[model samples]
Target chain A: MAADRNAGTEPVVDMQNVSIRYGTDPEVLSDIRLSLEKGSFHFLTGKSGAGKTSLLSMMYLALKPSSGTVTVFGTNIGFASRDAMALMRRRIGVVFQDFRLLEHLSAYDNVAVPLKVRGMKESEIEKRVRELLRWVELESSMNKICSTLSGGEKQRVAIARAVINRPEILLADEPTGNVDDDIAQKLMKLFVEMNRLGTTVVIATHSQELINQYNYPRIHLENKSLKVFPALRRLSNAE
Target chain B: MQNKIKLNHVSELPLKKDQANLFLEAVTAVMVFLFSIALAGYMLVDSMAKNWQNGISGTLTVQIMPLPGDTDSQEKSLRLNKVITFFENQPAVESVILISETQKERLMSPWLGQDVDISALPLPELLDVHLKQGADFDYEKAAQALKEIAPFASIDNHNVWLHRLLDLASSIQTLALSVLWMVLAVGVFSIFYAVCTSLGIHGQIIEILHIMGAKDDYIARQYARRGFLIGLISGAIGTAAALSAFWWLHHSAVYLSAGLLGSLDISSGGWLLLLSLPLWAALLSTATSYWAVRRTLRKIM
Candidate 1:
């Protein structure tokens, strides 16, 4: 693994007085200030339509803040050119809740997209993609079209794609939502392993059970505002 | 486990066998066909105009008519010799040849009956006057000189009728070229519309690719490739159709009046240009699609 050129004292993601709104609609999120240090793990928890996806979108450089600044990897995203934004996005991996995979392509091809987008040679892409798919227990279904795959299979494929690049910042939206407990734990372990390797991990989920099992801070969204809760086990241990 | 994967089967954007693209290909084929035909027509007319100009310019025709009620052949022969001698003495005249009786009879047979005795009629004596290339000859002065030698003699410079024919050919060439340009414009617009529609159709997939760190060029390249293939295949079809039409026209032209229509033959260089239309079409389509995709993607995240 190569060292992240952006690794430094600056937080991996820094949001200041950020607000987001759709066209002609009220703000989905407002006046948010947050920062995540490098190599940190956090769970984003919110009710339906609480703008969890929007926050992830901003961090992933998909959506610009309606007001204020969103600085990802130490660069203010509002000022980034489209090409620059694309480069920044390459360092950040995202798993959408809907599992945005190219349905017409095979699972192998879906996992290979990030590497292919980076212009990696096909041989290296094949080795990396196959290894990741095997780790996700999708080797048997590697050649199956994504549209024909079950929801849990699609979820695993999406996770494989997100982690294939070993992104500097990994944002997973309900990554384990469709998987069973065993696979969900496996997926969580994968994220934990990535974090241990210096990848910042952010998981957006409604699964409080999974949250309770993991020793990470929680950013809870309610009424378009956010509150941070320290890890319960860590708080108890401190007490 | 299969050790080899055919990566060509994989596309980040699923754009294969799209119905909209099929329609676009059909439209492109039709446009290319029209463009090829118009281009070939323009080339043909241009070639004909050049040939006619080369054959007609710098030459004059002199016709000595029979004297009124003069049945004496000696008198007519004297007048003919006088006009021929006058042209032969001019410095600009390269050579003057009296039209053969057989050739005159053949020329008149087209208008008169084939068996009619041309000698019995008061047919004018014709002479072909060839002038030296680049010679500065005054047509009015030459005609005036010829009239003085024989009162009934007239010099046909062939410029007035030739100019009218050349003008008509030039207008047709311009019209054909204009049609070709219009076809190309329509081709570009059709490709643009197809690419824009594809972008809209694949909007979600495009956003997903973007979120996955794909650049505008990355996605635009896929469309460009598709556009290029469509243009190439469609252009080939259209060019083939146009070539067939030209073949039929060439075949049919052989039976028509050869003197008026000329050879109807396109030169080797003209053929090469005609054959290159498909490549130009492909390039045009590629540029149009690439531009359309990039322009549309600029509005996206």
Candidate 2:
């Protein structure tokens, strides 16, 4: 709630000369420097193995950057303790590329996990979980076990789970990959609505058509480096 | 302070939640209960052996020889009243019970044929001597005293047979104790194995809970709670079943052991001790859970 909603503030995410690698392997991300402001919508486009997942992992604090200073919400990530990282995680929601829904829980319980972890009372959890399930159009399938659900359903459930706690920042990796184009458009619209409500949204996708349709900034990954393109300029030039 | 919030996050049990864990908990309880009952039974056996040994520790028997004359008149007519008085007056002998001819003939009834007239047949006079608890009796001194009254009289100490019986009882008790120890060790190891499995399966869930700001104690509490429930159910079932089996065997042994069975009744205290099995099982399960969670959590963070 303390996050800036008005214009003219430091970016929510600021990375300078940051590089990430898996163990001692060659750098998967190189010299990445970027700034993402509050309430901004951005799409990350890259081919497979172009470090898109690795970069998103860094932003979500799943993996620490191998070099340079990476700050999330003006706090240096590398210096943060485990408790701090968990608190920071609460502020950010991530939709994994694999749609990592816990297989043993029902769809409703899976979505309710983040809320439960925050110690929300049962009644409040029920109300919020029901609302989020409806948002994902999964209200009818709330009691179904995740293992029995279809791929698109799983992706929606994962999205519902990530955003259920009303995170200030949401990062989605290939959220629409398993769904049809129509569903992909709907998910994109949901992200836009969240952005309008002051959530900083970053979506990693290879669908340029979906990216082009939205009037949002783009950060494209090519040869392990990130390139940003202005959203308003591109839209105006197209018109 | 911030750790409290994290604790709340990690406190939830892994995805399948309480029901599935209940099944495993019940299993653990049963095993521990069985283990406890076996231990109590062993204890009971040991107590019985001690009681028997105390009853027979320092008693001695003496067999008197028949007079060298007419065998028909050598029985009750040759009343050795002087020898009996002398033995009773001895300081080493606390009390002496003179065996009557009828009683001596009755004692030998099992080995000898029936219809033997006590007035016609010559039989040895048997003396039962009870020694004072702290008094040390020399066999040579007692024998010499008895021989001066009548030649051909021998004192039987009865130590050899008593020693063999005591040794047999002690060995049985030791065997039962060894068995009880083995079962307890197996129970502990079984719980350890189950805890290891739980850690392996729920490692990620534990990690997520950690990242959610859950403290080590919070997560461990969840696991311990599950284990406690399981141990309770399993321990109760196993203990009840074992008791039933023991009851059946005990009843059947009454006819087989020729009235010695009633003397070795499983005491109420023994039953009370056995009833603690479920509690022991619960404690064991929870302890195992706590140890596993702490060790695993440390490795993760």
Candidate 3:
């Protein structure tokens, strides 16, 4: 009930009266209403099993809510055709906590997957992937198998892969977990840069330090509902 | 150590143990082996039947048996000589040769043993007659003339019973071809299962691809390519094994002596046909994977 208003901007993500349940179980998320403005940065913070990942899943069009509708870029996620949903997903970038990289692929190959999916020319994909990996300091590990990489290195590779296509929306779930302070800071910097470049970014995490360290607005999920709060630091002119 | 794997842009040749199973490859090889053998057998049987048909239609067997009332050697020779003269005088008969007693005994040796003498036993004489190509000889008139010379003589026009041999060969050929079709179906189903298993193991990666905005066609094409390559390699190995078997069996008189596959020497053209099966196998596997993966992705995504 405490979700934010649309803020008079074109909404990139809009969820209205959404409630979800599996079979006869209790509703995990009940009557949640939220809208994400285009070109805005927001953080999602919640306790374990408070439906942080579930909300992100719905935003990416992977799951449909049981009762209500969720729309991405004005297309109803629950009602759109599969092909239409696929096109919508192409404009969104996702980074995961586990860094789901194919073990057989090298770092460069993993990042090139999206471009290859789009049917880009081999030379173009190769050049872009190389440039992105070089930016993430993974140029040395480009040819290394993903499974052999350290936790920090794998997450950086995941970040590079997510932003390769300059997606209009970006979602990261626990992007900074399982890494030291320096590595976490580096990953945060990458996300911050992606947001400044006009991508609507959403990050879901349990880290209070990140919330205290950054001035981004926060959406707190508790008891199957969401409440939005302005950041404690300097308020943005855009806000 | 990791082998160098060449990759193209559109294919997801996941060079990992989880993506491909050797069991699938082995099953494919066995199916292709069965298919190759069945096809080769059909060709061999069809060829033998044709040869026998040609030879039988162009020849006659005049069998002369002695009458019981006058069973003397003089009477037997008189009847045989007259029949030989009559056939020689006919314009349609190409050549006629009386099968000698020694040759008769040799023909019967398989049943009578090598040293057994059939001199005392009454045996009919056979006149092996060859007809000229395109000759229009009235076989009924020839039978009537032989009957007048000796009531016990009969003409065995091999063309009469040769139809039955052809029928048997045709039936066997049809059966072998049916078996080949069935084996191909089974091969396709096997590949379907293999591709499905690979997808099951890599569900997480598939979810990631879905997140990456890969369409259903793109994902399915990757599996199709994988299936095609696996089928080509496995089918080549299977065909090589089957051709080797054909060579070994062709040289062995014991196996080839029985049944419709008598004395087969595969032509170069036939060998070429056998070598091209890997391409067919690759295509079949590609189609099967395409259908199977589309179905699975529908259920998955």
Candidate 4:
């Protein structure tokens, strides 16, 4: 992997003093200033009530900041219309914590949904979906409904669906939380490979061991502030 | 730019699964078609019956009773000629056509035996009279004038039976119209309920598709296309069933009306009316589905 550089250059996401609240309650995310440069890999770590999902949702254009500026792909996202937001969302892949696969559709159909929404032809869509399913090792389970899949299989399918369209920004929220250690490590390696292909990847999880083991740049949220662990980087480099 | 999106979405519609639901839809469509045919037939036949009765009412029959003195044929002839002339001069009369002996004999042949010689038997002179447009026939005045010409002459106006038949025909027609309206309302209600059930079952599927970047139009298209397919099927099935029923009724009615003048032969115009039932059913199903889908989507938003 390339050495860490200034996040301001070609930043894929830029947030300035962002605060989010749901209907005038206590602020969940407060005064959060963050930037992730193009093709960078970052891990978001926080407690269960630390609003990690809220922050990832904002990155994927699913929520709006209550007070602050949000810029994605150089566009002022805070004022973007719904249509514009929907169009922008197609370029961002999100792996929801719950593995939000449609239960009615098969694994293959679920993966092809994003591409189908973009009006891709059947031949191209089939080739792309088949390739992605094979990548996730769900090729044999293509005909099975999402409900029939195991936790690890479901998570892999969700990840495959999120990245099938080759999104510029990939957001995974507790993507491997429900999987075994072996599967989790395999999924982490898959994310690493994806990050190397010039696709910015952001994983939000509570697992410090996974973050420390990988030694990627980490952003920690505590007391309504974002902190980057520069010492963890040195530890990984020395080792 | 927005129109381009709308047009493109409309043109490249997705192909839905060919399942058993489609078969049920076709059957429903055909039933509707049959219902339409019956309604149209009733309306057309009822209208024709009214027109025929109206024409019959406007005509009057004059019967000259046979003279007791058979040898006084010249006097009877002179009296009938004078009575005809007097009626022609009357402002209420348009024109009078005196029935010749031969024509009267032909009219009586159906009721009486054909072998009977009309010349030997004493027969009354019958004259057909038509009233002028915008002129009311003064029955009292015309009767008084006819009595002066021949004391035995009697004027008969066919309004009593004509009025009664007209009332019967009008009542039948109104009843048919009421039945048709009932069928329409029932059809709409049934479709509405069915569509609501369909939407309820597919609610989660729709929401999932929406979150997966599908547009509202795309989701609505899936439902509308399904509805239209069902409508087509129902229309055909309903029509076929209605036709078969109508044919059976017509055959039975003809058999029952052996001595009656009118049978159950509906006119071409009436048949055209019956054919409209299928189309109506199809349209009702489609509209109901559209409304159901739209209403459900609104709740989600």
Candidate 5:
């Protein structure tokens, strides 16, 4: 309920003229500006090396921008302390394309991680984790080791883990890149369901078919610049 | 029904159970074993040195040998009795026992043989003098007093051999302490290396946890706790092994040498120090892992 501030009231993520690079190499992202309103669903579409992951990294506070400010929840994290940044990251849940689930832990434990890190009580954590797993239709495989799950099942588990804390924002970097079309569609529905319940969702993908399949605003990355396609283009882009 | 499945508190806790931790624990155990040996050696030598000082520090021996060519048993007897009376008169002297001919033969039989004529060789008259406990007797004065009683008589306080034994004991103890220090250094470095390796192997799991809003301390604690637990268990085993070894070795030595080195048992303080090894090792391992985790995490974020 803390994030139930009116949709379009204040942006959840605001990146202002951000530029990022690793070491002495060329900037991966340059002069990139992006903003997403609360309770909105948006797709970050770009080619393989068009800096989509880099932009999402900035949004999650995993990478600092080189020469510009990145504000999350109305706070600039360009110079945030390590503790402050970690606290900020809890509000954002990320699902990597690789489904970075801990292979050693069972599905139930994998989803309980975000809550455990916050020192949640075990009873409360168990109830909440079971509930979230049930939402993803993974309650049957709750005890299965993450590595043993199918690609579709793993993606679902990742989603459940991301949204378990009811994060104000959810960022997925190509969540369906490794799954079949049937499974991808199901995963997309999970994201849409989360968005409908007031969680801002950002999915970065280069799959044009996925982009065209949905009617939502999109932020496209090209030549180090980010361009926004509002909801009207959803029909045009789909057609 | 599947709700009965075991769920860990944290998913990315560590590099999980692996041979890496087991190997590191073995290394730590070896270090603790070596340290315990060195400490036991140091304690045993120190205790022996103290005992030696106590025994020889308050005793003196006086000998009266006649001129080599002179055949004078009557003169020797008179001078020996005079020397005994001179010592018995001194307030510092607790008791002085004059050497009887039978005792002299018993001491000389090893070198001279049992059948040799005892009267054929000129042997010195000996006196054993014990000083009173807490007596501040002057050693040089006692020697001077004995020399005046008979020109051929001289006193030995056993200072030369005592000094040599004490010096050797101290050197051995110092070397043992140096070895203990080296073991500690190796223990710390090895623990640090093990923790860093675990962190590297579990890097992805750590990154996932980090992205999920896990603090650096929370991430570090996983490895730190494991490191501490391994070190503690191994250290305790190593300490126990060392103690048993020392006990067996001391008893074997006593058996082989016919009860020699019986004083090799570690004193109470030394036992306390040895028992503290596990705690010290655990603390060191925990601290090393904590720093390693913090440093590794900092490099990424």
Candidate 6:
């Protein structure tokens, strides 16, 4: 496996001279270079329409760069086959800004999707999914359809699904956008707990307060370019 | 709760109750119905032709006209007896039966009204000569000998008319088979269109699945299963409808022809083949759906 071939020596994600655009439209992101080491956590900060989602999409193997290379888990996204990209995606989890839960499904089923897609045994899936849903304090609402759930509840389900597989990298876009401050802090703690367990995390958000509350480095998108800001506070062991 | 989980595992895509799927099922049923009828027609014609060829090939008809200006009934009887004796003496002739007046009347009733008195009309004497199964009789020599013995007698080989009938039957079978092929092509195209439409309708779920690391085969299997079920159900309905129509037609034909069309019966094996059409339809549907899904997914990110 290419992943095994470059294990421990390569960054989890490495992008060099990457540019992306849709059709004849002007490039949304231009000449970007970024690398994310394993077990690291960072915040992606940018104004609206600044291509933050576009960059995260490149990392998650959802979009190929218009030019240059995006190498994820040691496989270049440009050269990887569709099956290979799927396997690569297995090691990454994503939380879209809209939650993107399968609304027709129950919260339990939505959270169980990642494991089901992986073809895990039902018993194993049930155990893991129930445990995670309980941790997110959604055990009671697990059987309710996601369409009926409040925004915060749906966000939790989405988070439960993303982390169900214990993916090596977790990317969130405005994950806390629809939650109260207390729920947002709890969600942050969940991401931090995942990071403490050696999972790399990247969060995209417009909340300056959330960014201020956490002391992680930031990948800020500006004027179709990228600039990385180092941690502003001393690091804690959990972070 | 456990049952719900198991059910959820059965299908990750929420593809049920789409108007497109209902349209597909209706279209599939109609196509299968047409195909089944065409196939049955082909099989029936093929069997009928075989029966006719077998029955007609081993027999010859000899007709003796009444002697001109001779009112002697004994002379007609004597000439028919001489021809019957001559056929009996031939190595290949099995049995020759003189046609009874009643039998001749029955044969003529279709052309001439039943009310007509056949005795009033001077009908020719007809003899049915059955030959040995593998007989290679010299038809020309027999005809020449009959002319010498009774100048008014002539032999009917039956092959000329039989060949014409077979040609007509063969043409019908070919037309039926062509219709069957056209129906199949239309069925495949309809299924392709339906699957593509479903894919478009469920595009968001599919993208979410792909982002969740679902393999193409994973999603394709669900669609295949759905296709198989729809095909099986619609195929059953179609084949059943066709079988009912065939039963009605067979009965109506037998009634109208007064048992003449009873020879068009399908053999047991043919019936079994007809019964298996639904399974074939289901398999075709499953394969088409799987292929269509895989091909479409390849174009996605």
Q: By lDDT, who's the top model here?
A: 6
Clashes of each: 0, 12, 0, 21, 0, 0
Off by over 4 Å in 6: A1-9, A233-239, B1-10, B68-70, B89-92, B111-117, B138-141, B256-262
For model 2 chain A, the run of ten residues with the poorest summed lDDT: A1-10
* Tens-digit per-residue lDDT, A121-221, candidate 1: 88798889989998999888988889999999999999999999999999999998999989999999999888878888889999878887886888999
Interface DockQ of candidate 2: 0.19
Instruction: List TM-scores for all candidates, in order.
Output: 0.94, 0.75, 0.85, 0.70, 0.87, 0.93
Q: How good is model 3 by TM-score?
A: 0.85
Considering chain A alone, report the TM-score of candidate 1 relative to the true chain A. 0.93
Candidate 3 chain B weakest ten by summed lDDT? B1-10
- For residue A215, model 6's alpha carbon misses the true position, in angstroms, by 0.9
Order of models, best DockQ first: 5, 1, 6, 3, 2, 4
Question: DockQ of each candidate's interface versus the true one?
Answer: 0.59, 0.19, 0.42, 0.16, 0.69, 0.54
Question: On residues B53-159, what C-alpha lDDT tens digit does candidate 1 reach at each position?
Answer: 88888888988888789888788788889888999999999999999888888777757857877877878889999999999989998788777767788998888
Compute the lDDT of residue A198 as modeled in candidate 2.
81
Q: How far is candidate 6 from the true structure (C-alpha RMSD, Å)?
A: 3.8
iRMSD in angstroms, per model = 1.6, 7.9, 3.6, 9.2, 1.4, 2.4
RMSD of 5: 4.1
lDDT per residue for candidate 2 within B10-128, as digits (tens), equals 33456235434554655565566556556756765666666655665577777767767845644434555656676677776788888777787776665574676665556677877
Task: Write the number of the candidate with greater DockQ, choosing between 2 and 4.
Answer: 2
lDDT of 3 by residue, A70-163 (tens): 9899998877877788889889999988888876788888898888888899888887888888777888778888889998899888888888
Error of 4 at A52 (Å): 4.4
> Candidate 3 on B86-106: residue-level lDDT in tens?
888889999998898898887
Tell me the docking grade of candidate 2.
incorrect
In the order shown, the chain A TM-scores of the predictions are: 0.93, 0.92, 0.91, 0.92, 0.89, 0.93
